[model samples]
Target chain A: MREKLIEFRNVSFRYGEEEPWVLKDVSFDIYKNEWVAIIGHNGSGKSTIAKLMNGLLFPQEGEIYINGQVVNQDTIWDIRKEVGMVFQNPDNQFVGTTVQDDVAFGMENRGIPRDEMIRRIDESLTAVGMQDYRLTEPHRLSGGQKQRVAIASVLAISPQVLILDEATAMLDPKGRLEIMSTVSNVQDRNELSLITITHDLREVVQAERVIVMNEGVIWDEAKPREIFAKKDRLREIGLDVPFIATLADELNKSGLRISNEPLNHEELLEDLWTLHSKM
Target chain B: MDITFKNVDYIYQENSPFAHKAIENLSFHIPSGSFVAVIGHTGSGKSTLIQHLNGLIRPSNGEVHIGDFRLTNDDKPKNMKELRSRVGVVFQYPEHQLFEETVAKDIAFGPENFGVYKRDIEKRIKEIIPAVGLSEELLERSPFELSGGQMRRVAIAGVLAIKPEILVLDEPTAGLDPRGQKEIMEMFYDLHQKENLTTVLVTHSMEDAVKYADHVIILNKGTKYMEGKPEEVLTQQEALNKVQLDVPEMIEFLYAFEKRFGLPIPFKRQSVKQLADEIQHAMKEAGSHE
Candidate 1:
């Protein structure tokens, strides 16, 4: 049987006892090697969902099952090893001055041997295409490079899944693309499950599955095309549709009938060409 | 307006071992009352260029002049407080800069610092708060308690209380959800129209540059790469790509149409709706023969 990597069985959480529940009746199952995008607008409890997966925030109402081990005070420390987290703001996340040192830190905490740690650090850094900059100071790197290092740090630990908490939001367009491209490569090479928590629709265009959150609950969940089909519903929740999807919708509204549900430039071009030739 | 750089050069920590050049021999200008957009790759020195306009950073070897207040390699005072007041600068993540107990106090900080009287500051806050879509009732609450969108407005209000003739925003919509981004951009457009505000915008969104900017200046590797009206800058897509800046996909699509059909269409148009309308008209006109 393909293992149930992470299962959130009707989980709920809040910042404080008096506060309204940030996550209510949330439930989903993430499988091995699936790249899932948790889509939401600001204050939608998407970040809280991620925190719960990594054991940073324990669910208040229900339980989180990681590899069939329930996440609780007793098993959280063990669960953290199975789910690695890469937070936003790489500047704040760097615990080490140099890139190599940062990548080695998590392994060091795990009591891995010095030589094995060194080998894995190199492997992870190279996997993220940041081996050349391993000796460079983390602070001196750009946002994208810093984020790659952050990913490398997590990858060194070799968790079954990596949670990126809006890790690409703050970067410039070029930087964002670089980070996403690197992440895509790593996901393919390592077959690591990815849970990207973000509002940027562009970042999640090719995700295997998408779970859209609204006001602490799953508003809708579907495959990328199926989910993006509800363009108006998505926009109503203060989220922009993927650019190509947006273009297709606008074209449809204007009577320029396009057939394909394109989420990107190349696909949009292909669809438009078919329509133009048919005309 | 007309912010010509004129061989402007700026160095960070000059004469020290850690000395680095930020902007080197750069030159450009934003005409008065015209919205100019600045785009550049990271470390291309656009931030330094913006700071130069307000005298926040002085050139190490060249000079920069704003209307009358000038900055040179060797001249001008240490404090350009007057210059700063007239040129309202809204920073990226301006919400993070908010530190007042109340929104009104936060907005009042800039004017009060510049010796604007209490009554005038109150009047200024009242005038602009609504413009930013924040009501007066929300003014007494802690600035931190407001939503990110509202907090950004408070920060903008802080800058607007100074009654600047020119507004320079460095990625005002960065880190905002698309809805929040649209809200802020529309608010800026409104402010620019209602007050005749001369706006210099630094943005990563080529769509925003084409949508709002009358003129566009592009920098690459700390030097001027291109400068023209939006139509002029966007027409040369290859140069923009070379500098790692994205052109609006719609604009690219329109250009492809002209290339394929040899259609005498204006490809510089940015609006997708406008392009679609033009395409239908052309098609229907041609199909009349069929």
Candidate 2:
């Protein structure tokens, strides 16, 4: 059986008594080294799940477990060390003047030894392809580069699970691609559970599994292919399938044989060629 | 307003030790009432280029003509405020600029500052409310109380209230969801048509440029890399990739299809369904020929 890194059991939460519940009875499990993407429209309680996993906010009704330990006041600090989070705005997350200083900031707060901090800083920056930019100031770097630095800082903590909370929303298309590839590389090198909270369907297509959130609830949880198959339903819920999925559906409607869930351009084209040969 | 840039150059901190050129020797003409998309990377001087639209920054070593107003390094239009009243810029994260107590007040602030009549400001608010997908009830609510999408709509409504003839959008759909992005872009397109506004959109999404813009300008290292119709300019895949840009997914797919099936389906900005129809016809014709 796959080891579960994080689990939410019948979680429900609200900010205040008068306020409506932001998340309602949501439950899901993230296994070791799994890349799970949580997608929803704005204010859909998707981001709340990220906050709950690391004990930033406790669920009023249910429990969140991290490596078999329940998250509460006493265990919150320890749970936080196990889960690292990268927020949306790169400008707001910077606490250091230079790239290397920022990566060392997290480790310094944890009171790591100076020699060990230096070693981890170099290792993490190299992991994110930012080793050459160690002395570069945050302002000198591009949005994509700054985000890579942010990822390196998170990696320095050596957390078991990493949560990116709408991390690419403020970046351009190029920056978004850079962060995605960097995260993929880091995951390959480490046994890290990735929870990406985003609205971009392009990024969602790369995930191993997807959890769809709608109106403070778990609308659906499935693989990327299964989730994208219901294109019309996704649209109704204010989410979108990727362009390949939409185009594949169009080709199928025009009496052409194509997979309903082509993940990329090459796959859909290959299916079309197979259909053409028989004709 | 029609815009023309003649050998434009903008140097930040000029003559100082830290001097850097943001835009250099750029020349382009945007005809009156045309839609233009400026495509480039983050530091490719897109923001610097759009700032010249409203006289926010004067060209360091060139000429800029927006309608009757002219700007140069030494000379700017005496009536700078009037030029600003004619150009409305909806910046990235425009909601952060919202400061008024209520949505109605925020929408009225721009027009009121421009000396528009109080009665006319109220009329424009009423007309712009629905144009931005905001309802009448939202006019009384505080802008901070609204959701992210609603706050953005409120911010856009404020820009539209100015009744500017030239509209500049700098990644206006940056943080919106997929559906919200489509709705906002469509609304802007409708307003552009109904008002005959000259629209300049600085965007990273090539899909938006292909769908909405008639003309496209690409910048690389503060220079004009390419400029022409969207179909002609965006199809140069190698040139765009050199600048860290990509063709829209539809065009990319058609290129791959041609390579794989030996079928050439030219992209004329066709919808997905239309492209599928053309592909089906091409396959049938090829089979018959065989």
Q: Check candidate 2 and list the clashing pairs.
A: none
- Point to the candidate with the largest lDDT: 2
Q: lDDT of each prediction vs. the true structure?
A: 0.84, 0.93
Worst 10 residues of 2 chain B by lDDT: B235-244
Docking class of 1: medium
What RMSD does each model have against the real structure?
Answer: 2.0, 0.9
Error of 2 at B19 (Å): 0.4
| A238-278: candidate 2 lDDT, tens digit per residue | 88888989888988899887855788987897788888888
Candidate 2 ranges with C-alpha deviation above 4 Å: none
Task: Please give the lDDT score at residue B57 for candidate 1.
Answer: 75
**Number of backbone collisions per candidate, in order?**
5, 0
TM value for model 1: 0.95
Q: Write the per-residue lDDT of candidate 1 for residues A102-144, one digit (tens) a residue.
A: 8888888999899999899989999988989978997699989
